[model samples]
Target: MFQDYLFFGVDTKVHYSYRMLHLSHLVEEAKQLHNLNTNRALLLSDALLGSVLLSSILDYEERVNLRFHCNGDFTIGTETSFQAETRGYIECNENSEVVKQLDLGNNIIPEFQVRSMRSQRKKPNLFEGLTSTKANSLEKALNEHLAASYQMNTVLKISSWIDSVSGKLNAFGVIYQELPDIPEEVSIKLKKHIDSLPSMKELFLLDNDADVLSKKLIPDITKAVKSINPKFVCSCSQERVENVIVTLPLSELSDILNKAEDLEMKCHYCNKNYIVSMQTITQIYASRNQVNSTNSNEMN
Candidate 1:
């Protein structure tokens, strides 16, 4: 099986930077975890690739989130940590006429509201940007976000292909950012180089090492500065599920406890189910009241 990796490199002269990604295995894992149909898989794959591309700008321990609101009924979200751990999901109103009529295979939507959020591990502040595009292209929207938010010159390309025989998805992308103070001629040459290359699908099909591919894209990439393996990692856990249950209103907790059946919670990102037994719910309910009473007594 082919592993997924992201390679970071810079021009020999330090005039530009590059990030190359090979995410087919990671995307396949997501497709299986979410049990997505072809169209849903394609959209999620694109979102995943786009999110990783944006991660190039994140500092260590920081995270970036990408959300796509399609029309009014469909939405997709992807999150990637600076370490390249990624998770994403697709959501839609299954009964909505608009969602039912959407031909996602064509990769065309009437409109998309793209929002990006960046934050550090323990930071209280978040940096967010929102952009709207009618092009029905996630690539274009992401490029717009980078330009407007970071004021950097970047070109991003994401491509995905489905294997006809194995029904597997192969997806990858490249991010090229021209460093500040780059001469106009150098910038023009870089653009021409990117344009003249083969399609992303073709490049990915070669199955070349990420470093080798980076060198192909930017011949001046003397050495790789960073290499990361991105994988599908979900943050959901039983304790988190219990915390969610504890936050419910007394009535809701009572209703669930009265049922005498385990409450099942499913993670949106990985579709993993966590079962909260009635006994556990009752314990949490009691603990919630105990904590509240302790606070009340302290105030008194």
Candidate 2:
């Protein structure tokens, strides 16, 4: 069973979270949309898991977005809500030489960006960290980001099993963070205790269960404070897309109106294509003009 949750040590000195995803289906859906090969698909899976762990600590209305800009074959990104609904994608030129020799670790420096996803606010806040891919692992890069950017003493573990032949994926992972004001020696002892546990890959192979693994790792954890079920969810829809189309500058809309029978817009997150008919385009134009006219009159 797919499971996601947050738990804390009995004394609340440390916080932990985990996610187990039967990612084959979601990865297949992504592969079909983005034409992902094994390596690119694998990168996307890692980003998703990272996003899930990062977002788990956020407030209900807040969301976290993770973006990586690298010299690898692909620059991967993910956005996840506190509820654990996540979407991710990879950006790259398939024909470039870089793609031919794509290695996630080849990049000298990569930026990890975290941002607020709220739109109604005047300005959203952004926090970012920079790290080198010298170690050639996203996990290490992210741990560095946490330390450097947020000053958080966090250990992030991400793991996945993918079929080489089919490119199918199964992923699971966890994050542990030492809470502030804890004694340094206690922190060291606790971290060492955690380090002694099996790696995520080893744990998955042995039990395939997050709950069982969590208890083994932190026996005195508080009862599940919250339970979350995360999935691949997209926020694109016809009406939402239509609203965006209507906001485009009139000149751009006119170019589309004159040359194209229908406008095709593809979502960057899910790769869903939406085709807006010419009639809807004209209607949107009319509606925009009406709003502008009303505003002009009000100003007069």
Candidate 3:
């Protein structure tokens, strides 16, 4: 059981930043929770790893969201907090055309519209970027978004390998960004080194932790500045579901009350079901009327 972690470090002299992520466990958990096939599981895994990598650019208490709007109304998304907590979801029915196409071994990556958003806690403002790639690669789209939107020169690599015998997934990613203060010569050398690194398949075959991988990425990095454990955590709860129901129109609440049966809701991320009984619906309806009446009196 390999523990998942994100390792952060900086070049001792050039000040360039590096982030290495080992998140196969998180991806495995997501695959099990969603019951995804290999194609869907790989897409979600990449999105999850990419989101956590993108979170390294944010400040404390900030969060980043990565989304892919695929053809056939299918979508995959992931959100990662600075604390390294992450969740991801894929939206498409098993019998949908998109899943059918995937089953047929079609490559739908080129039709994806990728969106990245960053925001801080309690802040209403968001910094967002959208980009499309004809390359049929998620990493390329992500790099294009960062370059076009944030004006950052970054190299990102994401890789995954599944054990044939055990059916276990092994995924990792590394990002390198040159700081503004880094000398142009040093930046050029860093790019050359990055280009000369081993192929993703070769890298994945090596048994390495974040520390070892970070050093491999930037040999000058003496120590990691930060390390975070990334986990698959969905922020859904029964209370949150109730709150969502309370926001619905009174007519909708009344309709649920009329049925006299529980309204069942399933969380898309975790597939957990929550039952909202008629009693709860009636209470919500009454509460809405009470609030409306009080507002009318105050207005008068």
User: Model-by-model lDDT, in order?
Assistant: 0.83, 0.66, 0.80
Evaluated at residue 232, the lDDT of candidate 2 is: 79
> Cα deviation of 43 in candidate 2 (Å)?
0.3
Clashes of each: 0, 0, 0
Q: What tens-digit string does per-residue lDDT give for candidate 3 at 48-151?
A: 87889889866644788888887655788888888889999998766677568775667654466888888877978888888876656677777777777776
lDDT of 2 at 107: 36
**Model 1 lDDT per residue over 1-300, tens place:** 568888888878888888888899999889888888877787789899999988875655388988999776799989998889999999988976656655445544777888999886787778899888776777777777777777669888888779777889889899889888998888998999988888788886685666557767874545678888998888889999998998898779888888889999998888889999888988988987788889999999
On TM-score, the candidate that comes out on top is 3
Estimate the overall C-alpha local distance difference test score of candidate 3.
0.80
Runs of candidate 3 with Cα error greater than 4 angstroms are 93-98, 207-211, 219-222, 290-300
TM-score of 2: 0.75
TM-scores for every predicted model? 0.84, 0.75, 0.88
- Scored by lDDT, the top model is 1
Clashing pairs in 1: none
